[model samples]
Target: MGEKPGQYLLWNELRGDWCNYDIVGEQYHGVAIYGLLPDDWSREGFETQRMFELVPEPANPHDRWAISVRADGKTVGYIPRQDCQSWANVVRRVAASGLIAMVPGRIYARDAKNWDEWDGENDPPREFASTVQIKLGDPDGALPINNPPTVPYTMIPRSAIVQVTKEDEHTDALLKFVPGSGYGTLFVTLHESVSGRAASAKPVVEVRINDERIGQLTPQMSQRFLPMIRHLASRGLVTACWGDIKGSAVAAEVRIDGIKANEADEVVLDGEPVTLPALIDKQDDPETYALPGWIDMAVQTGARHSYESQPESTTSSTPAAPPLPPAAWYDDPQNHRMFRYWDGLRWTEHVAPKVR
Candidate 1:
């Protein structure tokens, strides 16, 4: 199946010693952006306060990754030289998508903003800069779903983002370090493996922050969400919220109907919004007398136009192109057994839904 490129693999869902991790990716987190440098720890980084922009020289656009930070307007040295081109490419890919979206990032401390630490010049420029880390989204975001696209454990609850609409202590806790006004979705991850060790596997969903295991799904909560979690996970819209309810027991609340079919009139695949083609062609040239096959081809093209023509014609702005088709299940263009939904117009929310 054809997949968009810019997507960098952060990690995989494989768990336990039995799972082979033959893939070795850049040491950087998520996508192309790398992390806080030890020598660049002179100051602390802010949450999502300042926006970031990519600065590349026309001459060495790929080779140089000049990220400019807003606020006082500081230009950091290029990302680690080794990762400079890679990081630049990711930004280019995202920008090229033409989607106004946010990618994950982290700013590390620096010994001196002026000095180009990676450049190895003790005499750093007097300009200000910070080490920035870029992170990619789910590495397997584009992988084909296995037959029914089984998710070993329940996926994160997207509805949780709305059910508990307001920002609360729980949401704040997970994204405390992340800057800007942002929200975090609570997800359940497993903690068991084939070797019977503490690894991400099946069943028990784990909860933690910064590698600190804080909680797990309480039996009561699991029983409540198990079905919905499975159903939503299949739809590729699974979401949930977890918190310390009582005595370290993890309690969760989920909302299912957060998907506003209209919120996005267009479809977004791989973070890029896409327009849909007309399901039925409204206009075509009259069948050519030269070819007998032309007539059948035109009839087989399905309904050709909207608003059946009456004997008399009335003038109206070409029947506002049929209200974009409703999002519906269609054979997966990428994978055969796995069908994806054309939400009326664009690809969306695929899961273990029974295919007709």
Candidate 2:
């Protein structure tokens, strides 16, 4: 019989290992062994050895293999053919099964033990173990949030004059002066005389100096009026007051920068009225404000027809022509009405009046 199918051992040339054969009376099956070999026995070495032992034992061992060739005249160990195949199958099955079993309880125990041993007698703070927390609340309920109230402030010019009067028991009339680019004046009037009494019935005019408390004023015989006002004026302070006098007012011209006033029937500065005209001119001509050099030129040229000539259709009752074209219409400086003849270059002397 040829070498028994299952009873023989062979060297796996591809994997460089020895294996066993399975013989079912006639059929053959392969079995592999897990082991190492001397480096000199592999193809990468000398390639002189063709086979190696499958098992270390001889008679009736679990698996056995033959040494077919010796490369360096040295001998190694043996392996059981059946055991080789079984070992290979077990390795393959274990590799294919993806389940990896771990012991969580054991791992935790080990970690705890290691930690206790690594850090002794001291521990981290308890607060450090907890995370921080934040809470948001509504803003409108006495808390700072969106949409807070705002107060606005505006600056008044130093030149502006202000007037104050007692309008009623609760309110006072305030007259204010506004200045234009330079110095201005304001005037005020009193409706009733201040009572020269010490009783609370007298009106009180309290003046503040640059937001600092200075002094108080009530029309009284004991108080010095002009000296007090003069002192306040010299110090560049703004005055405001409250009291019982009606139609009582004050006015003055204060110097300030970058303000100009126009002539109007009534001028109100910072809510106070000014009666004086801010600008003045002596000329009576309505057109004087609209045209330049009009008055002087009118005297030189005399009144001329308003148009080029009377329309051919007009009778003796026709209106005169419109005035001559402006002096700018002449191309040359010498071509004034005194020098140039009309040659159709411009309107005829009959059409346009000559300058004297």
Highest lDDT against the true fold, candidate = 1
RMSD of 2: 54.2
lDDT of 2 by residue, 173-209 (tens): 2222222212222221111223345664554444322
> Over the stretch 1-356, how does candidate 1's per-residue lDDT look in tens digits?
11211211111222111212111122212111212233343444432211233323323443324322111112222334554443343333333332111222445432234343346745543332234444333322211111111232222211222232212335444333221212222232323112124584335333433333334444433344445434444545423222211111223332221222112212221222212111111112211112111111110011111113211221221111112333433334444344354544566675322122
lDDT of 1 at 120: 75
Per-model RMSD to reference: 23.5, 54.2
Models 1 onward score TM values of 0.24, 0.14
The list of candidate 2 runs beyond 4 A from truth reads: 1-176, 193-198, 203-356
How does each model score on lDDT?
Answer: 0.28, 0.20
